[model samples]
Target: MKILRAEEEEALSEALRVLSEGGLVGFPTETFYGLGADPFNPAAIERLYEVKRRRRDKPVLLLLGDREEVGRLVEEIPPVAELLMEHFWPGPLTIVFRARTDIPPWLTAETGTVALRVSSHPLARDLPRLFRGPVTGTSANLSEEPPARTAEEVAHYFPEIDLILDGGPCPGEKPSTLVSVVSERVELLRPGAVPWEKIEKLLKSFS
Candidate 1:
C-alpha cells in the first residue's frame, strides 16, 4: 500500500484520483482511521464489507459536507437534531435519521435510518468533497479488531486498500458520538467524543 503524508497537497490529489476510480482509500479522522469508498457505488461498498468481514446487517455512516446535505439524505429532520448538528457537526457527533429512497439499501442496511457526520478533520472533509457523494467512514480494522488510529495501523490491518493517506495520528483518536433520531425519540447508540449529558441536553430543547 502507498502511504501519503498527511495534508500533503499532492497526496490529497492522488487520493482523490484513486477514489474517483471506485477504489478504496484509508485516511485518518478526528476519531480513528477509516476505510473510505464512494458511498454511491454498490461494488465499492461490497469491497468495504469484504475487507472488514463486516455483516450486511450493520450499516455504514456517511460523512457529509454540511447540514444542508443532511436534509437531502433524510426524509425528515427533527428540530432537536438540527440543534445538535449545528452545535456539534464538523466535530465528532454522528446523527442517525430516516434516510430517503435515494440511498441504496446496502448502504443503509435496508433500514430507513442512516448515520451522518460532518467531519472536522481536514483530510476527512476534503476526501468527501473530492468524491461524487459522501464516503463510508467505517473503521479500517477487520470486524471485532481494534480500530486503527494511525495510517500504518490501517495499512497493516487492510493491506489490499488501493491507497493510504497518512494524515498522522488521529486526534482525540475516538469514534464519533452516535445518536439516533427516530419517531421524535432521540437515543444514544454509542458515546464517543460527544458525551451523553451534552446530547441529552440538546434533546430537551425539542421538549
Candidate 2:
C-alpha cells in the first residue's frame, strides 16, 4: 500500500484520485485514522466492509466537508439537528437522520437512517471537498479492535488498503458522539469525543 503524508498537496490529489476510482484511502480524523471510501459507490462500500471485516448489519458513518452536504444524504434536516450542527459540528459529533430515497441500502444498512459528521480535522474535511462527495469515515480497524490512532497502526490492521494518508497520531483517540434525531428528540446512541451534558444543554436551549 502507498503511504502519503496528509499535509502534502500531491498526496491529497492522489488520495482524491484513488477515491474517484472506487478505492479506499486511510486518513486521520480528530479521533482516529478512518478508512475512507466514496459513500456513493456500492463497490467501494462493499470493499470497505470486506477489508475491515465489519458486520454488514452495522452501518458506516459519513464525513462531510460542510453542513450543506447533509441535505444531499438526508431527507430533511430537523430543527434539533440544525441546532446541534450549529454548535458542535466541524468537530466530533455524528447525527443520524432519515435518509433520502436515493441513498443506497448498504449505506444505511436498511435502517433508513444515515449518520453524518462535518469533520473539523483538515484532512477529513478537505478530502470530501476535493472528492466532491461524501466519504465513509469508519475507523480503520477490524471490528471490535481498538480504533487506530496512527497511520502505522492502521497499516498493521489494513495493510492491503489502497493508500494511507499519514497525518501522524490523532489527538482525540476516540470516536465521535453519535445521536439519532429521527424523532423530535435527540437520542444519544454512543458518546465519545463530545460530552453528553454538552449535547443535552444544547438541546435544552433549543426548547
Candidate 3:
C-alpha cells in the first residue's frame, strides 16, 4: 500500500493514474476517507466491493466536481433536486436521481437510480475533475466497520489498496444525508450531516 500526501502534486498525479487503470485509491471526503475508483469501470467497481467486502446489492455513491458532471450520469435533475443542489451540494448532501440508461447496473444496484454528491473537499472535488469522470465515494473500510477518518485509519483498514491520499483528518465524522427523488417526490433515505428538517423546509418552499 502506497501512502502519499494528498496535497502533493505527485500524489494527485498518482491517484489519477491508479484510478485510470481501474485501481483503488483511498482519499478523503468532507465526512470520511473514501475508497475512490472509476465508477464507469466495472472492474474498478468490482475491486472496490472486494476491498471493502461491500454487499453486492448495495450501490456506491458517486462523487463529482461540479453539477455539470450530473448530465453524464443522470437522465434529468428534477426541479427539487436542482434546488437542493443549489442549497446543500458541495457540502454533505447526496441526492439520488434516475440514472441514464447506459450507466452500468452495478452503479445503481439494478435500481436504475444513482446517488451523487458534489464534494466540498478539495481532494474529492479535484480528483474527479482530474480523472475527467466520476469516482466511487464509499467509505474506505470493511463492511460493518467504522469509516476511516484519516489516511492512517484508511491504511489500517485497507492496506492493500493501490494508493492512500492523506489529506489529514476528515472534517466531519458522519456520513452525508441521502435523499432519493425517484417518483417526483423527495424521500429521505438516511439523515446524517444534514438535518431532515432543513431539507423539508427547502422543499416546502416549492409547494
Off by over 4 Å in 2: none
Estimate candidate 3's alpha-carbon lDDT, on a 0 to 1 scale: 0.90
Off by over 4 Å in 1: none
Residue pairs whose backbone atoms clash in candidate 2: none
Per-residue lDDT tens digits of candidate 1, residues 50-108?
A: 99999999999888766677877888998777788878988889888988988789988
Supply the global lDDT for candidate 1: 0.84
Per-residue CA lDDT of candidate 3, range 58-132, in tens? Answer: 989999989888988998888888889999979899999999999999999998999999988888999898888
lDDT of 1 at 65: 60
Report how far residue 164 has shifted in candidate 2, in Å.
0.3
Tens digits of lDDT, candidate 2, 74-134: 9999888889999998999999999999899999999999999989898899999878889
